[model samples]
Target: MEKLYNKYEVYNRWLQDSDGYWQEFIEKTAGYIYWAKKPEKIFEWNPPNPFKWFVGGYTNAGYSAVDYKLGRFGDKTAYIYINPEASVERRITYGELYQLVCRISAALRAFGVKKGDTILVYMPNSIEAVAVLLAAARIGAVSSTVFAGFSPKAVADRIELVEPKIIFTQDYSLRRGRRIALKENIDEALKLSTWRPQAVVVKRALGEEKEPPMERGRDMWLEEFLEMGKHGNCTPEFVESNEPLFVLPTSGTTAKPKPVVHVHGGYQVWIVHGALLVYGLSSDDVIFNTSDIGWIVGQSYIVFAPTIMGTTSILFDGAIDYPKPDLFWEIIEKYKPTLIWTSPTAARMLMRLGVSHARRHDLSSVKRVVTAGEVLNPEVWRWLYEEAFQKNVPVIDHWWQTELGGPAIGYYYALVKDMPVGLEFMEIKPGSAGVPLPGVEVEVVDERGNAVSAGQKGTLVLKRPFPGMTPTLWKDHKRYMAEYWERYEGKLVYYTGDAAYIDDEGYVWFGGRADEVIKIAGHRIGTIEVESALLTHPAVAEAAVVGVPDPIRGEAIAAFVVLKPSWRPTEELRKELIEHVRKTFGPIAVFAGLEFVNMLPKTRSGKIMRRVLKRLWTGEPIGDISTIEDEASVEEIREAISRLKVVKVSE
Candidate 1:
């Protein structure tokens, strides 16, 4: 275990020493550029030196992704699109995808969008959405995508922040076998906005005027718009690597959502290097990530990463369990993609559907897979490895955040060739965040400002900047610094808001959030310890552990669990689960109560929104819940809690 990275001691040493860090940074970035594509200028430094990039780059993203492979691999397929209802699919060639992107870039320009202008795109996982994002980059216009499943309020809140002049949306979208009125929601958000965008709506499901437009510049048909730019050429714009390319939003503990800005220069640099290592990507690889372009994973993997590497990317418009539980398997069979990146929540659901769903189709084409967004429970990992893929394919349990643009910690397929069975051998300890990326530095410290030793837990902090880390929260620099930097100011460490520990081997394991740590009788207990123990029960499907205020103990443990189908909760079962926890980690990790539920409140990206639940339990006025992915679940949970009415157990 003696620090797996010590082999590259020279590189790590230079990364820490600031006087020499810039020299090493340039070398690493330059090396990546040369590997990705030999451009006219590898980098350029402008006056004020605010932005740095692949400098005077004479390379087109489209050419790198599509045009370069045209004559040589014109017949190589890029996307294998599957229609959920029809139970059929169509293969799109690399040349064909390139053409669509060019035409769409032309279409966007014909619609009056210009360079440096922002365009709001709200769509699901369709090929057209991917095309539009590339098209925006091709024309130098920034594309701001809103997650299609978000409420109108959520959509409008983002729109109001950026104030884009054009909004791209679809008439309807299909997901999990239901046709959602996407354009209708757009219409509602538009009504609330004082700024009017030239709205272009794709005819996805064949319904018109269901939601009437009340004003001018409100709606234009998708087909008509495409026709307007039919013969136009897509001469890709050469932008500085540090130029702002996309704006993403993250939910705040306070009322509003925080907008995070990422630049094309830094984003491309990291995406190329990170994807290569994380996914073992190659020019011939076909990637299938079941995510929408609205989120970071979709922005990076589904659109940018594969395309930047000049590879094929599969886009699935609906849920993994749409027409059947086998939709993902069906897509893999048809596309033969080499890589599939997704979240564990969906994987767990797929696991519940049983391996029969996978066995029905051919997944032999898949070579590598990744899971992210939230922590992947160890149980899900075992199930995916042994039961689903027959213990053959490697499951990379990636850990990163929206603020950290790419997969900072996970199984590096390129680096770890002989992937280990359990989670530990992949350069990371069981619960640790794993060792920091090549140049990034991580340290765990305590309240009095001192580093904790091995086996002890402390606040997780970043010692240096990586190219992918967000430079600032959009329109809120002070808040951004205060949130991430101020807490450990003089030390130059970025407070991650996460609690973690480093093992003797240098593997980093993440304990839950620092705030989630419960204090009982002068001892601090990580909620993850209790939650993990709770999930060991046969009846428990999933669990969320939180710390609630208590008079005597200062704080106590609360558990919310979603049980297996048809399993009724009883005092007897509850006692059994409590005893199970005691047996696993002793009585110090006891739960206040085991509350049963059908689903946990989560963000659109599958992250549990625990603060909302805390507010609910404490009877705080919930305000502007646009970010809540499951509004109905909040009501259901409240009703269930009222019915239970168990008295608070004291120490």
Candidate 2:
């Protein structure tokens, strides 16, 4: 439990201080925090407090992200591209990206987008997507980007939320060798919608005007729109620090997704400054962030932090395993990416591919590998460090959430530099999430609003708001208060919903959500969300959701579902349900194969006995089945499992 390394080194630049990291961060905050003032009532959290990062800042994100970099590192490469085919590559300097942002900002304005309006982007990881995002930031227009693989209905559901002024997409896209019809999905989503957006379609597959007419004024090709304006004014639309910059919708406990609104000045500044210390990312490093920009990891690492640092970032369009299992290594070898930031779920999957996949290509350039999305299990962590990085490079386990914009607790190299082998996590316990960043305050508290003693599990709460904390969920101020604020009515703490315990060594170990949420492959899926998804399938009569133990992912979704008459569970049906869930709610939804039952155990009040399911799945002794409406339900499930004998079945 003794301190593994000098913890004070995190706050003070005792290690890796080539750039004066902390001093630069303080200066950055000083310049941006006071740019604009907030009304007293609206400004609940203010600076001088660690939680309130940029209280009265009024600055354009464009200035902080792009222009600031342009001023300092004009010739530094802003973006490095690996074409969809991986046959061609290019790099865009900071100066050139700035110019593109200006022209695109003008193009967006010419297309009728304005300040305070919303723009929906459903596109691939091409330059246009990055350009459009920065363009929206330049104009002070809010942008909501839907993941490219989302189903039509899923896209439509998001479209209906913001009712964006314009929608950006591509005509077609190449993933590996297959051409996916991007415009076709957009057309289907918007075809019968009550609200119509002016679609700014980028024609990725040229020479085919294959899509039908664009309903007159509603749709225009990308070439035509760019032609409308040869140049942009390159002006930064200064927005208040508290104003919303983007709305990122995440899958909710319900079937409908919830949009998490991240503000402009604070969230952007959080990454700009925090990345310097936590990830040790620098202007000299080449980063290949494997996540799409639609997710927070991609938003924070690939787009925001790299741009802020004026470094090169590689964005890919297809599967990490496509073409070959070693594509990630190939990219690193080709690009010489100094930083590898991806999810632990991906790391675990790649670990299953074995060290041979990684050894197939040269990876000498990789100095750091960071994993988010889920807690890095020690087994997987050791594999990544020892097998993949050859125990020379550190694989950092980052602990944060979509709600907490960046790292709240993470393993930073600055503090853990000389720690022993397998002791990379510097702070406290073996499985613990490391201590908070320099200024943030965090605690594990019991129901009475008192801090729980070390090793006692309780609610994980942020005692104060950080610069990266979301001001509110989109149009749900009351819900935000109820979710984060109401637990400690008079206190400023935001309840994280996660359950954790801080050990005597000061490291926090997550005990999972206090509520019923299942994390499959590091993605948060509300048990209720998966239950609803199951109900949507035609054969499902009744369903109960629970999280089952997994070695790699923290937990996997397991459902005890009953079927309609004559609809027996077959391999075909299981595959159908899996695909149905995927189509309805993306890949995160399809966590496990459906376990069919003749009946589901429930209380007299119609509540399903999820606890019983959990117990059964974990092979624990069941308590009381007297309350079950049909006591035979458990027996039937056990018998079915016995017949199948699929203890270690992969799928």
Candidate 3:
């Protein structure tokens, strides 16, 4: 069949008739996979709440992602694993990966895992971790992963929610040459929770110091777990389209994290379609997704997306700048990936190391660089294009949330039937998150559910549900309806809770979170706008802005900034930064308070925890911070706030 639609046609159709466009898109992408039973309908939507896709289809995500590619590309490399030091490298071909996934699936089934069962994976990015997730999908079981660095309480809380049949983890994770005890954290978490699930431990570091003792009946070694599966025959379980595939917990900064659920057929379709259209991947390409498997990006791209496309994916289990600032560049030099997807915070962190480190390696193999976790500041975007990638590659910044499950608004690297060979990525706007993807319908609407005019900021909402969008929060359909659907009462819209505006050219621009927008003197300002303006200054490396209570203005803008290598924190520099914001964005952008700190508190995925900063300033109780990268960074901000108080008293 001829390619269904090109980039321009798809966008125009989406704008003209979104419902028709999405139905056709879903039908077209379905041809790429093998289905045990076809769907009865493309989608079914209740009046103002429930939405589902691929209503009656039956498919196995693991079979489609791993086993289906074996006949055509069995010998093709599936995964390329690299260590932090670039010393050890391993590659797993499609056929080999299939066997491993089968063994793991058999093991899970042997341990009494059945369809509809939930399994919790708490490990770093490794072959075992990926196999465990696919194994769960192979058996029609739901899997959820918590970041390896999460605290015992964080893990226990998630475990309490899902109550998985088995929990998979590794003995330890190596970060920056330091060994983090993963199994110990799991043990601690098990103690806190009342549920007793079987623990499957992968000995990643055997004979390195003393290994933790496994409990008699509760814990089993990975090898032994696989051995039990060797005696049993394992086959992929083709499940209904809407069957729960995985439950991913949201990384909300302030509120308790909720589990967002995605299904088999819809999620598989979206991953294959989105990876091809957004990241521009083919079976011949290699992808290096610099995200841990715990985050949504990692769950989608690092594991299922690339593998489903039968492409080589690089799984790096290390820090970006460990041992040397050029670690990422060095990996690129070794692996020569065509597409590199990472977080914006990583880009800023690399920017702080200067371009000299990146220049030392030959990055000619890289065609495109994409970032998504948070908004990409214009300064960092420019630096990435000009300095790091040398103005040759396109730096694509896309936008999506954990709830959406995939890219909702971004450039699509569409290749129509007429032009199938060679790479053809969409145009890249410097700061905007590009246009909506082929099947997604995005709109900026006012409080009354009316579409806002172009260039007017409003709440970002999805007019129609796409295949990749999460069905609902796990076991909490009411919360899902209230949080997303009920907000725009009487209208079937998915409120994103993000303040955004569409430009005259049809590109979507994000203006921070709606709740995070600061209202001062009857004027509303986006925290991202102020943070972006501050980043334009030469000495500033990173900045996080928040709103603090103000008697006169109701809420005032407060900024926390991290300086460049040579610049030191001083009252003069702070004043100059405040003045710089005023000059760049007018008086409204001037911060009521600005503090220079060594580092901003961030999640493991590199998102700045602005809520933590706000709470520290206002003396509010800071909630669970187990996912924070550095607890000391919060202390640094606290000390800066203390100094501000001392200055206030002196004044």
TM-scores vs. true structure, each candidate? 0.73, 0.86, 0.79
Which candidate ranks first by TM-score, i.e. highest? 2
How far residue 2's Cα lies from its native spot in candidate 1, in Å, is 5.5
TM-score comparison, 1 vs 3, better candidate: 3
The CA lDDT at 176 in model 1 is 53
Q: Rank the candidates by TM-score, best first.
A: 2, 3, 1
Total backbone clashes of model 3? 0
Candidate 2 pairs with clashing backbones:
35-58, 36-56, 36-58, 51-465
- lDDT by residue (9-110, candidate 2, tens digit) is 543331344124433453544432224343222224442222333455566666666777766677888787766364556788888888888888888787
The segments of candidate 1 whose C-alpha lies over 4 angstroms from its true place after superposition are 7-73, 86-88, 206-216, 230-233, 415-433, 447-449, 487-489, 515-651
Per-residue alpha-carbon lDDT of model 1 for 1-651, expressed as tens digits? 246655534335535563344333435444223223333343343322232444434333434455555665677777666667645456678778888888888887877777778888898777777777778877778778887876675678788878887788887766555667878788888777777788887775443436434345567877777898987666777665555677787554333556777766556666765676567777678888876677888888887777665677766766677777687787788778888887766776787788897888888888877877555667777777777788677777766766778877655467322221112235322323455555457788886658899878887787766667777766676777766663354555677766678778676777545655554422345565566667778899887767665433334567778899968888778777777766543334545556778898877887676766666766776555688798987886676555534654322
Candidate 3 lDDT trough over 10 residues, lowest sum: 1-10
Find the candidate with the highest lDDT and give its number: 3
Clashing pairs in 3: none
Measured with C-alpha atoms, the lDDT of residue 168 in candidate 1 is: 86
Model 2: residues with Cα > 4 Å off, grouped in runs: 1-43, 46-53, 84-86, 176-178, 206-215, 231-234, 415-430, 445-451, 488-492, 511-514, 549-556, 565-572, 601-612, 620-651
Give each model's whole-structure lDDT: 0.67, 0.71, 0.79
